[model samples]
Structures are given as C-alpha cells and as structure tokens.
Target: MKLAVIGLGMASKPHLAALKLLADQIEVVGLYSRSESRRAAMAAETGWPAFDSLQAVANSDAQVVIVITPPNARAELVQTLGAAGKAILMEKPVERDLARAKALVETCEGFGVPLGIVLQHRYRAGAEALADLMASGRAGKVLMARVSLPWWRDQGYYDTPGRGTLDMDGGGVLITQAIHVLDLMLSLAGPVAEVMALTGKTPLHQMETEDFAAAGLRFENGAVGSVVATTAAYPGGAETLELECTHVALKLEAGALTLHWRNGQTETVGEVTGTGGGGDPMDFPCDWHRDLITDFAARVQAGQAPRVSGRDALRVHRLIDAIERSARTRAIAQVEAEA
Candidate 1:
C-alpha cells in the first residue's frame, strides 16, 4: 500500500517510525507540511519526498493519507482527500469544534471514503483483553467506571503557539491529554448519557484552556462514572481506568490490566508501559501506533471499516464537547445523539 503523510509535527515522527515497521506491506510516497523548513528538515532526515502543497499530495498515487495536523486545521485537508477518493487516517480529537467534526464525518460518508482516527489505546493488548472479557459476559454488567489522568506539563510546553488554545489544540486536559483515557472509559462502560464538569487553568500553565478538569458521568447502561484529569499534578502519575462489575473489578493503568474478582482472585494481563508522566508530552512508545497503522492497512486492503473509524471517534468528540459545555454553562449537559 502506498501512503502519504500531511503533517511534520511531533505526531509525524512516531507515525513515520511506525510506518517503517510495516515497510514490507506499506510505503510512504510523499509528505506535506505548511512549514517549508520543517518539511525540508524531514525530507533531509528521512529521504522521503516532501510535497509543496496538500493538493500535490492528494494528487499522488498514495492510496491512504495520514493527517497529523492540529484539530483546527484538519477539516479542509481531510475534505480535499475525501473528495479525491482517498482513505484518510487522522489524529485524535477529530476537530476542536463538535459541529465541524460532524461535518468532517459527513464529508467522508458523502464521498464513500473510509475515515479512521488514531485512537491507539484501543489497540493496546490490555485494552483488547479487557474489552474481550467485557463482551463475553463473564465480567457481568459494569456498575461503576472511573478514569484518572493526572499528567504534568510544564509552562513551557504551553508557551508554544497553539499549545492549549481553544482555536488550535482544542480544550486542554479533557480534549487533548485525557481524551485517550476518556475514549477507553467509553469503550469499557458504553455511552455516557450526561456529564457535569468543571474546568480551570492551573498557575503552572498560562494557556487559554483548562489544565484541570473533573466530571460526573451517567452512562446509558446504568453505570455511574467519574473522571479527574489534570496537568497540574506535580511530576504526573499513571493514567488509570477502573471498571467495577457485578463479579469483577478491572483496573487498567497505562496499558496494563489487573482484575480483582468477587471470589478474592486477582490476575494481571497484557504488557505495555505507560506514557511519560514525567512532564514530557512526546514520551510515548510507538508500538501501539504500529499495531493501529498495520490494522488500518489490512482493513483498507479488505475494504472494511477501520477499528476506530471517524464515526466511532465522533462519540469521544461529543463527550468532550458535552464536558466543555457543562463547564461553561454550569449545568449537566446531555450528550448529543450520534450522527
């Protein structure tokens, strides 16, 4: 499979490395980035052809296009690729604006293009085992779900342009850093019916969006949930998701899972380390990205929907939107029905 990448930001590096792992099956044909210098640097470093414009990349023979641009800058480029009948794989938080995200999903659907989001947590071994256990009905119904992502980001991290802005990277913590845990929570507990949240910036960071967030959630399955996310936690801590079912309590810390059953039995499953809680934003390993990208390539070859399709990612976006709205309105926000 021939592929093209459309951003040379931090995400592009891991993605390129992961694509290399699948070199026997896939080849990166071209790259495009708005920053000429960055593109030149990437080209010099990787020996990959760098296109001058999005149209040039779109016009290439690449069958799949990977978009690692910021959430605010994704729609137009994605729409262009979709119109050209190319499969698109986009980074998380499909769009900063919920309405625009919905429009992007619709655009892909209108053109019959397959759109996938890089929610790599879903491809983790522990998460996969947990999801399997939940689906097998052996774990019983989930009673309570909770997620905590107490990560740290120094002020300098946000000092960069468009770091935590509402117009660029989208909402902080909840949308940017914690959305992976939030997506994992949704996967384990099912859809959230309503949410009440509060958001605020910490003294540590001077960005426009919140560095801290807490929320109360009510799921459609009668499961109660809670979320606490903050970049203010000193030195950061592990990102954890816990699900209490009638018979078993499943806890996932980073990418590892531990199950405590009602019968006094405990078991650990899967292997993968947590991303850096040491205040480095780019500290994650690219193994999960490799798995996700490989899966996308196989799914594309089979003409099937990817594991985390655009429609699938829209749910997480809606949840984030609801949390932000609830924070602003100081009232419980009902999650909009899926489009």
Candidate 2:
C-alpha cells in the first residue's frame, strides 16, 4: 500500500517513524504541509516528494493519507480526501468539535472511504490484554474506574500561539492529553451514560481552556468512573487507569498493567515506560503507533474498517462534549446517544 502524509508538526515525526517500521507493508509516496519550510525540510531529509496542495496529495497514487494536523484544522483536508475516495487515518480526537467530527465521518461514509482515528493506545499490549480480560469475564464485572492524567506543561508551552486554545488544539486536559485514557476507559467499561464535570485554568498556566479537569462518570454498564486530569501537577506524573472488577483489580500505569486478584495473587503484564509524562508531549515510543499503522494498512487492503475507526473514536468525543456541557451548566449532562 502506498500512503501520503499531511501536517509535519509534532505528531508527524512519530507517525512517519512508525510508517518506516511498516515499510514492508506500506510505502509513503507523498507528503503535504501548509508550511513550505516544513515540506522542504521533510523532503530534504527523507527524499520524499512534497505535494504543494491537498488536491495534489489526493491526486497522487497514494492509496491512504495520514493526517497528523491539529484537531481544529482537519475537516477540510479530510473532506477533500474522502471525496477523492482515498482512505484516511487521522490523529486522535477526530476534530475540535463534535459536529465537525460527525460531519467528517458522514463524508467518509458517503464517499465509501474507510476512516481511522489514531487512538494508538488501544493497540498497546497492556491495554489490549486488559480489554480482552474484561471481555472474557475473567475479571468479572467492572465496578469502578479511576483515571489520573497528572501531566505537566509549563506556562511557556501554552504561551505558544494556538496552543491550548479552543480554535486550534481544542479543549485542554480532557480533550488533549486525557482523551487517550478516557478512550481506554470506555473500551474497558463501556459507554458513559452521564457525566458531571468541573474545569478551570490553573495558576500554573495562562490559557483560554482548562489546565485541570475532574469529572464523575456513570457508565452504561453500571460502572462508576472518576477522571482527574491536569497539566498543572508539578514535575507531572504517570497517567494511570485503575479498574476494580469483581474478581480482580487492574491498574494500568503508563503503558504497563498490574493485576491484583481476589485470590491474593498479583501479576504485572507489559513494560513500564515514560510515555511522555513530565516531558514533551511528543516524546514517547512509536511501537504502538507502528501496531496501529500496521493494522490500518491491513484493514485498508482488506476493505474493512480499521481497529480505531472514526465512529469508534466519536464516543470519546461525545464523552468530552458531555463533560464540557456539564462544566458549563454545573449539572449532570447526558452523553449524546449514538445513531
């Protein structure tokens, strides 16, 4: 399979690196970026042809296009690709807004193109194993879940123009950093039925969106959940998801998983790594991205939906939308029912 890449920003490096790992399955045939300097730099570095426009990318022989642009700037490019019948694999959170995300999904569906979201955490070894355990009833029913994303971003990080803004990066902690954990929570505990949340800008950073967020969740499966996310935690900390099930308690800290069963047995699965916590957001391993990209290539070739399809990712967005609504109203907000 031949592929093209758009947006040469922070996420571009990781995606490109992962694509390189999958060179046996897919080849990057073209590249695009609004910034001529970035395109030139990438071309000079990789010797790949950089297209001048989205139309050029769509017109290329590349069968799939990887979109690593900001959440707010994806609709137009994705619509163009979908209309051209090119398969698309986009970065996480789909879009800055739920409506536009939905519209993008519809456009892809209408064009009969497969759309995948870059929720690569779902492909992590620990997460996949935990999800399988939950599905197999080996862990019994999940009673509750706790997610903590104690990430830190200095004032200078948000001071960058378009950073942490609703127009560009979308919402703060919840939508940006915590969406991965939130998506994993949904995968393990099922859909959130309702949410009540509160958000505010922390003293550590000056930004239009919240630097800290806490939410109460009621999952459709009767499992309760709590989410605490912040970029204000000094020096930051590991992002963890603790699921208390009837038979066992599972804690996924960073990329590793630990299981504590009712029989007083404890076992750890997978490896622990930095995962960009307390560091630059883009600083993390590309293994999971490689897995997801590999899956995307296979799905594209098979004419099937990718593991993390657009519709699969919209659930996370809907939960975030509900959390935002709850924060605004200071009341419980029902999650939007999916069609």
Candidate 3:
C-alpha cells in the first residue's frame, strides 16, 4: 500500500516514526507542507519524497493519507483528499468544534473514503487488554468510573502561538490533553447521560482556554464517575481510569492494567509506560503510534473501518461539547449522542 502524510508539524514526528517502523508493510511516498523549507527539512531528515503541494499529493498514488495539521486546518484538507478518494487518518479533536468535525467525517463518508482519527492512547497495550476483558465479560458490569489526568505544562509550552486557544487548539485541557483518556473512559464505561462540569484557566498559565476541569458524569449504563483533567499540576503524571465493576475492580494507569477480583485474587496485564504527561509533551515512546498506524493500514487495505473511525471519535467530541455547555450554563448538560 502507498501512503502519504500532510502537514510537517511537530505532531508528525511520532507518525513519521511509526511510518518508519511500518516501512516494510507500506510505502510512504509523499510528504507535504505549505512551507517549502519544512518539506525540504523533513525530506532531508526522513529520506521520504516531499510533494510540491497538497493537491499534488492527493493526485498522487498514495492510498492512505495521514493528516497531522492543527485543529483549525483540517476541513479543506479533508475535502480535497476525500474528493480524490484518499483514505485519511487524522490527529485528534477532528476540528476546533463538533460541527466542522462532523462535516469532515460526512465529506469523507460521502466520498466513500475511510476516515480514522489518531486517538492513540486507546491503542496502548493495557487499554486493549481491558477492552478485551470487558468484551469477554470477565470484567463484569461497570458500576463506577473515576478518571484523573493530572498533567503539567510550562507557560513556555503554552507560549507557542495558538497553543491553548479556542480558535486553534479548541479549548484546552479537556479537548487537547485529556481527550485521550476521556474517549477511552467512554469506550469502557460510557455513553454518559449527563455531565456537570467546571472549566477554567489557572493563574499558572496565561491562556485563553481552560487549563483545568472537574466534572461529574452519569453514564447511560447506570455507572457514575468523576473526572479531574488539568495541565495545572506542577509535574504531569499518567492519566488514570479506575473502574469498579460488579465482579472485579480494574485500574488502568498509564499502560498498565490491574484487576482485583472478588475472591481476593489480583492480576495485572502489561506494564506502566511513559505517557508524555510531563513538561516535555513528546516524552513518550512511539510504539502506540506504530500499532495504530499499522492497524489503520491493514484495515484500509481490507476495505474495513479503522479501529477509531471518525464517527466513533465523534462520541468524545459530543461529550466534550456537553462539558463545555455545562460549564457555561452552570447546569447538567445532557449528552446528545447524535449531536
């Protein structure tokens, strides 16, 4: 299979690394960015062909296109590539908000293209193991879910133009940093019926969007949970999702999954790994990205939906919308699954 990657920004680093690992499985022929210098630098760095323009890449022989542009730069790219019948795997948040995000998905679907979002956290080994456990019924019914994403980012991190802004990154911690764990939480114990949240920016960082959030949720499955997502913590740590189920209690911190059974037996799957929660955002390994990219390539080859399809990713977007609404109205917002 032939693939291409667009937008030569910092986010492309992990994807490029993943592509390097999967080089034997597929050929990455074109890399594109608006800036000629960026294209030259990346081409020189990775030894991959750089496209003259996005249109050139779309018009090329690439079967899968990875879109790694910022949140504000997705709609037009998706439109162009979709019209060219390219399968797109994009980075998270879809767009700054839900409406544009939906349009991107619908555009690709309407054009009969496979669309996948890069919410790589769910691809962590421990997360996949837990998903399997729940599917096998050994995890039983979930009664409660508790999540915390205590992450730290220096002001310099936010100092990057549009780093923590509504127009560029789409809100702050909830949409950017914690969307990974929130999506995984919804995947495990969600379809949250309602959400009551408080979102605000702390004095620690000068940013337009919320850097901290505390929310209470009621899942449609009768499970209740609380969430604390913030970049205000001095030193960021791994995000955690602890589920208390009917038969077993599960704790998934970073990449490790642990189970506490009713009969006093405890078991663990996978091991704790760096989550890039600290001052340096790109501190973690590229293995998760590797697995996700490999999976997407195989699925695209098979004419099947990628694991994290655009429609499936909209689930978290909807929940984030509800959270923002609840924070504004000071009311418990109902999560409209279709909204």
Best by lDDT: 3
Question: Number of backbone collisions per candidate, in order?
Answer: 0, 0, 0
Provide the overall lDDT of each model, using Cα atoms, as 2-decimal numbers: 0.89, 0.89, 0.91
- Candidate 3 residues lying further than 4 Å off, grouped into runs, are none
TM-score of each: 0.97, 0.98, 0.98
289 Cα displacement, candidate 3 (Å) = 0.8
Model 2 C-alpha lDDT versus the unseen true structure: 0.89
Model 1 poorest 10 in a row by lDDT = 271-280
Ranking by TM-score: 3, 2, 1
**Candidate 2, position 85, lDDT:** 87
lDDT of 1 by residue, 1-339 (tens): 999999898777679989878788898898889999999999888888899998898889999999999998987897789989999999998888788888888999999999999988888788999999999999999999999988998988888899999889877888788889888888778999999999898778888999999999999988898999999998988899999999999999888999999999999998648576657777878888999988998899899998988888888988999999999999999999875
Candidate 2 lDDT, tens digit per residue, 243-335? 999999999988899999999999888888767768587778899999888889888999887888999999999999999999999999999
RMSD of each: 1.1, 1.0, 0.9
Question: How does model 1 fare in lDDT?
Answer: 0.89
lDDT of 3 by residue, 63-104 (tens): 999999999988889989999999999999888988878888
Better of 2 and 3 by lDDT: 3
